[model samples]
Target chain A: MSNFPPAGVFLVGALLLPLVPRRVRAVALLMPPVASLVLLWILEPGQTLTVPFLDFQLLLTRVDRLSLAFGYVFVIVTFLGGVYGLHLKDVGQQVAALLYSGSALGVVFAGDLFTLFVFWEVMAVASVYLIWARGTKRSRQAGYRYLFVHMAGGSLLLAGALIHYNATGSLLFEPMKGGLGATLILVSFAINAAIPPLHAWLPDAYPQGTVTGSVFLSAFTTKAAVYALARGFAGWEVLVWAGTAMAVYGVVYAVLENDIRGILAYHIVSQVGYMVAGVGLGTEVAINGTTAHAFTHILYKGLLFMGAGTVLYATGRSKLTELGGLWRALPLALGLYMVGAFSISGFPLFSGFVSKSMTVYAAEVDHRGLVVLLLNLASVGTFLHTGLKLPYFTWFGPSRPAAPQTRVPWNMYAGMGLAAAINIAIGLYPGLLYELLPFPVDYRPYTFAHVSETLQLLLFTGLGFWLLIKMLKGEPIITLDTDWFYRRPARLVYVIAVVYPSHLFATTERIALRLVQSLVSASRDPIAALNAATVTLFGRYPDGRMPRRRHNTGDYDPDRYRLPVGVMGLVILALFVALMLWILLAR
Target chain B: MKSTWLVLVVVTLVLTVSGDILTRKGEYGQWWYPVPGFFALLGLLGCMAIVVVSKLLGRYWLQRREDYYGDSGAGE
Candidate 1:
């Protein structure tokens, strides 16, 4: 059992997928995650699998409640996403999904920084393909930016791992004492967590991913970063404010976004804030809240992405301005999507209700008044944008004549139905989720006061939506985000770094090619070549280039171009002597 | 249909605000919990403010055309 780690299942499954017949590929996709879930369920806490490398132990499988909590969701989402994409014939996307989820699983279970770093980098490389799979000009550019950003983050994580190992002579990935290494490591996690300023890549890229790929994309990367922060940087005070700022930041952008996936992408930043803040609180309840929220978030967010994906899949458009009156056409998609919207809004009978309250309650208990207030405000925005604004303008707004439609595939519906059921089940019986939380729980989602508080907050948000509905419809425009700080200047950088240099290289290469051709012709007919060069250089031309019409004017004649044997031997001998003399003199 | 939807939102809002007000913050909620509809209005007004402020930011500062990033690479 120790010899085979859980990540190996998905990773190995990905490598073997092409061998499987195309017709059954989607069914094949479900097998690995199913196997991973069973393996994780059977593996008890306190299990460790270690492999030796150099002077350090690579702890590849560290099974405990924390890893178990993340492990379960990673595989669950992989299975759900597989079902969502069951209609896909694109093997590239299938392989990427498997590999990306496998790496995420690897990160959670890894006990050493080295192990974490390897999987961290693999996760980045694999997930970028999802964005690139769309093969549009926009997706191509976005994929490059996503790849570059994540690679930069991965580099920081690797540097932190090296520096920490050098200082402490240990690589165990656990809570760190403050230093350069820990700071670098925290920033790396922050980037992946989509903490603002660093967050623009997310909304920039996720909307560009393939429909099924976006569903997988929405589930994994930021949540995995949340898991890492929970493991490494819990109680770091800066995270409390950073997380709070992100919560509001995401909500604000969600309001402004014209793209539906873009709106959901921004909210990923918003939802992750609670988990990061809980990690910052570092209380037992807070950690439990963080884990529980992560678990519920992956499911509901996947459902939302699947819902949006169904819209995009059927209509071939994702912008809210181009989408409307879809309720008549995509009713099932709307119903399933509303389940997600309700869950994310923390409606009383959904999974988010059970989970989201715990983090806020923890903040209140910790007496962090500002974090509590700001997170609450973010929620108001959350319900407003995701629940009311997006749906209002999308499914229930005035129909656009341009929008096209097709019947959504059953697998997409099957995928969304499964996610919606899980969300409602957890909402109805909180213990279903609570039992899996890393810490013992005493929080209740359905207390008279708590439910009343949630209802007023969400209901008034709905009222605000109805009143503001006219202003809330998406314009056919893009909004500038923090990405503008980089994206606007990216072309300038491309010119300076790529365009100008390539142009210079091309000119140089042309001149060098002319010189090499001249020298080759000279070696063949030395007398004629020298006379031509002399005329060009000293009289006819200012430049040293031999005239193109001189020497071999017609097609090359191999026999005529050959140098004499004696002259070739002399040249080789001269080259050998020069090399020997230069070596002797330099020594 | 729109007016009916508006009325539904209003009635639900009224019911929840009253329920919150009736519930006792008797022992331990902070000063604002005693205020009926405090969170409700906060939700309403807060989201309204978010929309207004965000739109203002968009109009003045943040919004741009789809090709704002020079995505076509034409001029570049």
Candidate 2:
């Protein structure tokens, strides 16, 4: 226990998950996260688990409040997500879920950049299966892009780690000094944090993920990036602006998104933007705000994705334009989803009211006037989309409800119920969440001014949503984001790299097709082809075009006999090469 | 639902009117702190601007047909 990392429970359990028998494997999926929670609870801060490898001591678990906060949320979501996916028979997906949650825990507990990179990659690789588990053409394609983007992020992290190690001769994952190495490390975290252009992968992939899969997806990846940013790039002024930009950028896209999960996905970007801005502020209040937000966000956001996923699960469609008037049919999902919606909209007595207020308060405390204005504006949009627009369009809008495809499993409700209860619990007594913060801050969330301010903002935003409800009606269109820069140009790159070569081969095949026809005909009349070949190399037949001897090639008729196209291509290609060589030798 | 919203509206109005009685009488951070319903205005106008700007941006520049990337995975 002293040497074993908390993440081991999930890693080992993932290895054993397939062997647990499919009947119980789904139930068995809950064990690792439970075990991980117990271990994280027991594991004391300042306890370090390190393994010496190749002259480097790899610190796998560096227990601290920050890591523990993330560790607790990560495990809790895994458990809840496992419950959500309890009806799954796909052992591959179950194992993937376990490994993914495990690796994210590994990342949180990673005490060194090298260890962080290893788990960073494992998290990326394992989480992608969640998307692919959906087993649709779109999910498959989204999975590839998701994989490629994260790999690029991982590579940057590795390069940064190596450069930092080289420059400082220390691999301790602490506050980074100004240099190329640290900058690369910051950029890597920014990509994972979904800071604009590097972000499109997240919203693109998460919506395509399996219903249960996205619940866990919503918890880990970007929050881990938020944790990394807090650890490595705290106090960087650039993050203040960058994070604010992302905060606004995400909600704008959320307003425009048609997919239920995509709107939620964009909100992830917006919410993480608050954490990123908090890390930039680098005060005790700011850091605490980021950590507190990440902790509560995992609960509520997981709940939101669950609600959206449930709608998808029951109706077999996720697009807003394709669904509506479902509140009566899906009352359980509707009630649970509204809890999440209220929590996220920062309604008093909800978790977001406790957490999101802190970060905005931090901006005010820091005298960042513009940051305060923009973030408050983002709060308005957050309510507009996640709270009002999405629920209205999905549950009570013009479209008739699609029929339920399957009964929502008991465990899905169990998962959602547990998360909803926790969100409320934290909102009721934020002291519970406040205790887990990495730093001490004398902050209160329930002040009359604070409560009234949040309520007014959210309520008035609701009024705006009511007025523009017609315009906010989701059309079946996707709004382009920074990802358009790559996803669009990726086609041109594909044409140059793959398409052009294939077309050239097609042209070669066309030239070869005629040669093969002539050769096949020549099998019956060898004399005619030999005469034609003898006339070549600028030589011409006396009858102007070529000697036409179609009837005499009696054994081979184009209509009666057929050779495989591939065979004809190869033969004609060989003949042309040889004929060119012979002509060269003769000359 | 209408009564609930009406109650919420009443509560919000009462809180704003009694801001001095319900809260501290000092600057919180910004100049708008003294003004009642300041955040309410911000929320309304901010929501209005965001919806308009984002819709215009999406329709003119960003919005695309779902199959814009094409079903063939853009020749993947």
Clashes of each: 0, 0
Regions of model 2 farther than 4 Å from truth: A503-587, B1-24, B72-76
Using lDDT as the measure, the top candidate is 1
Q: Which candidate is the best by TM-score?
A: 1
TM-score of chain B of 2: 0.60
Residues A1-587 of candidate 2: C-alpha lDDT, one tens digit per residue: 85379889999999888778779988899988887787887888899988999999999889988888898989888988988889889998899988898999899999999999999999999999999988888899999999999999999999999999999999999998789999899889999999987898999999999999999899999999999999888899999999999999999998789889999999999999999999999898999999999999999999999999999999988889989989878889988989999988888999998999999999998988899889999899999999998888888888675878799889899989999999999999999999888888699999877887787788778778778888998888877787788888989999998999999999999999989988787886775565455555435443344435634432323543467788989999999999999999999
Residue pairs in candidate 1 whose N, alpha carbon or C atoms collide under 3 angstroms: none
Q: Best candidate, DockQ-wise?
A: 1
Q: Score chain A of each prediction against the true chain A by TM-score and list the results.
A: 0.88, 0.88
What lDDT does each candidate get? 0.89, 0.88
lDDT of 2 by residue, B1-76 (tens): 9999889876865565466345645445677776767787888899999999998998799888878887633332
